[model samples]
Each structure stands twice: as structure tokens, then as C-alpha cells.
Target: MTGEKVSFGFEDVSEEEKVSRVKGVFRSVASKYDLMNDLMSGGIHRIWKSNTIARLNPQPGELLLDCAGGTGDIARAFVAKAEEVRQRRGGEPAMAIVTDINDDMLLAGLEQRGDDGLIWACADATKLPFPDKCVDVVTISFGIRNVVDIPAALREFRRVLKPGGRFACLEFSHMATKEMQAAYDAYSFNVIPQLGKIVTGDKDSYQYLVESIRRFPKQEKFADMIKEAGFSKVSFTNYTGGVAALHTGWAI
Candidate 1:
């Protein structure tokens, strides 16, 4: 059943349908996504994201390839952190190359953030446009689960990294406590889409957001997938009691 195709949402779907559905969700929720992230997580996403940058151990003169990096939140965070380190050490600044699979998201980022050393490209995660061993670090946040092929994307992350390059993926993960699951489930199933409808006028797309998290590979299994992709020193750190997890691996 490993290769058996499944659709997004609760419906049974062919692989093609899943792709189409996910695309629609991003397009529909593009404008409201950043806001929804704040609302749904009660601003904890900022903490989760901040923690991700902290783990990157950002360094100067390093090149960061940000995958599925919509709106450049990770890019902004990286730039800020990298700049702070440079200021402290009086060294060169790190560079951030923002990459995303969606044009609307990329364009929104460019229009909102402007060109301040942030590079934007419309590229798929499974087919990254970079040379082998090219980037010093690769990071994907909240966007990997939206990918059509997780394993292929993982392999691609490995392929585009320099020797000893770092990879960090921050994603929604299964909840840790059984007591919390029901509350989370009820919030996801009943409250989330309704909140979306009230706020963004789009309920179905938010519904997809809830379901995709459930469909994602659990934490340990995902670490195994990263290892299988030829990444050494693969490990994960759970956050907010497993509401989200950050997986880090090195290409060695």
C-alpha cells in the first residue's frame, strides 16, 4: 500500500486529483495564509518559525536555498538572524534565495517585501533548479506536506546541497498527547474551516489544510525517509508538544 494513490481531503482521489486540489488550496488561500497561520496557532507560529531559524545556526558568507518558501517569512527570519550574527562578529552577511512552487505566492512576497537581497523563483520542490552540491543550506517550512511527492522532494533537497550542507524542514506533525488529540481534532474539523470562512471567505481550502496535516507521514517515519534519501545525521525536534516538528539532516 506504500504506492497506493490517495486524494487530498477525506475523499479518495487519484494522484492527479491530489495535485490539482492542493494547487487550488494555495491559490485560493494565498492572500489569507499568513493571517490564518497567526489565527489558527494563536501566534505560536512565530515562535515555531523563530525556533526554526535559531536551529539553523545561521552563519555569515553562507548561501541558503529556501524551498517552498512562500512570502519569504523564513527568508526574512534568516536574513534577520544572519545579519545579527554578522553585526556581532563583524563579518560578511549570509544570502537567502527564496524559492516557491507558486507564482502568486512568489509575486506577493516580491511586492510586499521588495528586492532586498531576497531572490524569488517559481520552481517545484521535486525538481529544484540548482547544481549539485551548490547550496550551503536548504530549508522548507510548512510547505513540504503540500508537495506532491514527498520522497522525491526529499531526494532533491539532498541533491542540491553542498557537502556537509544543512537541511531543515518545519512541518505540522501529529499531536503528542492523546488528551490533546480530541481537542485538536474538534478544533480542526469544526472550528478551523468555519474560522476560515468567517475570516477569508474560503472554508474548503482550510479544510484541505487540516486534512493534509493528518495525511503527512508521522515524525519518526519521516526521519527514516530523510535517511533513505541519503542524508546522514538525520534527526527531528518536536515543538509545542508535537503540534509541529522540525527535521534536520546533513548531506555528507
Candidate 2:
């Protein structure tokens, strides 16, 4: 992966360069990252996340590793659900670790939510810092596309999960209908950058985001990639006309 070139927005960049470039993009937008998500998705991002949590069906005492869990949204959701189950059953809450490659994003998350009993760490998705079979579930929400080596990251996710553990990912995906796709393309390419500039005062970062979403593999292809990474029972559920999707598999 050293000499090979990967994508940075619409441009092709060396693997090392792409990593730094993506980190820069997140750093630039870190201050307003959550706000940008709200604006970009018209608050539908929350719904998508809630649906992910529903599908995840988090259990008490299950450890969850949320890779690239920017601002700890997914981690928080998992923890909250775990706590709910614990309260009903009179047990302890599950553990959650929120990991991201960018310190700025992690720091921003700390500022907003103050840890919430979560372990916040700056760790790369492609090479996690966990031992084998350490966690019961691994999740990445709206973050996998930024990974320079997605297959490596998927393998890492599989490595960290215990047998029968689950891996779930929620990300921007291909729209299901042609008309919706056309409208979404026009909006993403046209309106998102303008919103970013107006809100975050950064247009290029949002442009890169749109391009990266386009570069991510479609749903079926991504599921295949997960299967190739040694996961079983791989499946995906598209939300909001496939604007976002949740892919789940078990480390069987």
C-alpha cells in the first residue's frame, strides 16, 4: 500500500498522503462536525443511527468497539441501550470504547459529552490496538470510507471480535432509485459544499466528503468485501432510500 495510490476526494493520492489528507479534512471540520452532519442530512442522520442501534440490539456486558466513532455517537447509543437492558435485568452496563484516528475529533467529542464512561482513544481503524477476541461487537458509523485500507480495517475488526461477535457499519450508500439518485447527486455535489462553507467555512472538506462517498463500494460489493474478510451471515439494510446503509456480519 506504500507505493500505491488511493482516493482523496476525486483525486488519486498515495496511501500515506491520503491518510494525512483525510486527517486534515476532519481536523478542519472537527469544531462543527456534528452540526454539519445535522445540516447535511436534515436530521435524518439521527434516524439512521437509531436504526443501527436497533439492529445492533446491544446486550448487557457486551463490549463494543466503535472504530472511527467520531464524537462518540454510536458508542453512546450502544452504551445507553446496554444500560437500559441492564436496568431491566438488574445487571451491569456493557462497555464501549470509542476510537478515532484524529485527536481533534476525539477531543471535540470529549468537550461535548465528557466521556460518559466511555474510553476515548486515538487509534487507526486499519490497525486497532486491541487483542484478538477482546470485544463482543465492533461498529463503524460514517467513518469507514475515510480508511485508507478498508479491507485491512475489516480484517482488524474481525480480529478484535470474539467468536460470534458482530460487526456493524453505517455509511452513506448508493440511492435505490434513479430519480432519487439524480436528486441526491445534484444536492450532494452542489448544496453540501455550500452549506459547509456557510457553516464550517470550509468548502473543500465537504467536497472531499461527497467524492469519498461516491468512491465507496456499493452495498452488495461491500458485503462481499466483508465476507472476504472472514465474516459470515453478512447482510445490509439501506436507510432513507439507501442514502445510508447498515452492514452487519458475525465473526463466526
Question: Could you tell me the lDDT of residue 213 within candidate 1?
Answer: 86
lDDT of 1 by residue, 46-93 (tens): 999998899898888888999988889898788888888899897888
Error of 1 at 106 (Å): 1.1
Q: For this target, which candidate reaches the highest TM-score against the unseen true structure?
A: 2
RMSD of 1: 2.1
lDDT of each: 0.87, 0.94
Q: Please, what are the lDDT tens digits per residue for candidate 2 over residues 60-132?
A: 9999999998899899999899889989986767999999999999999999879899999999999898899
Residue runs of model 2 more than 4 Å from their true location after superposition: none
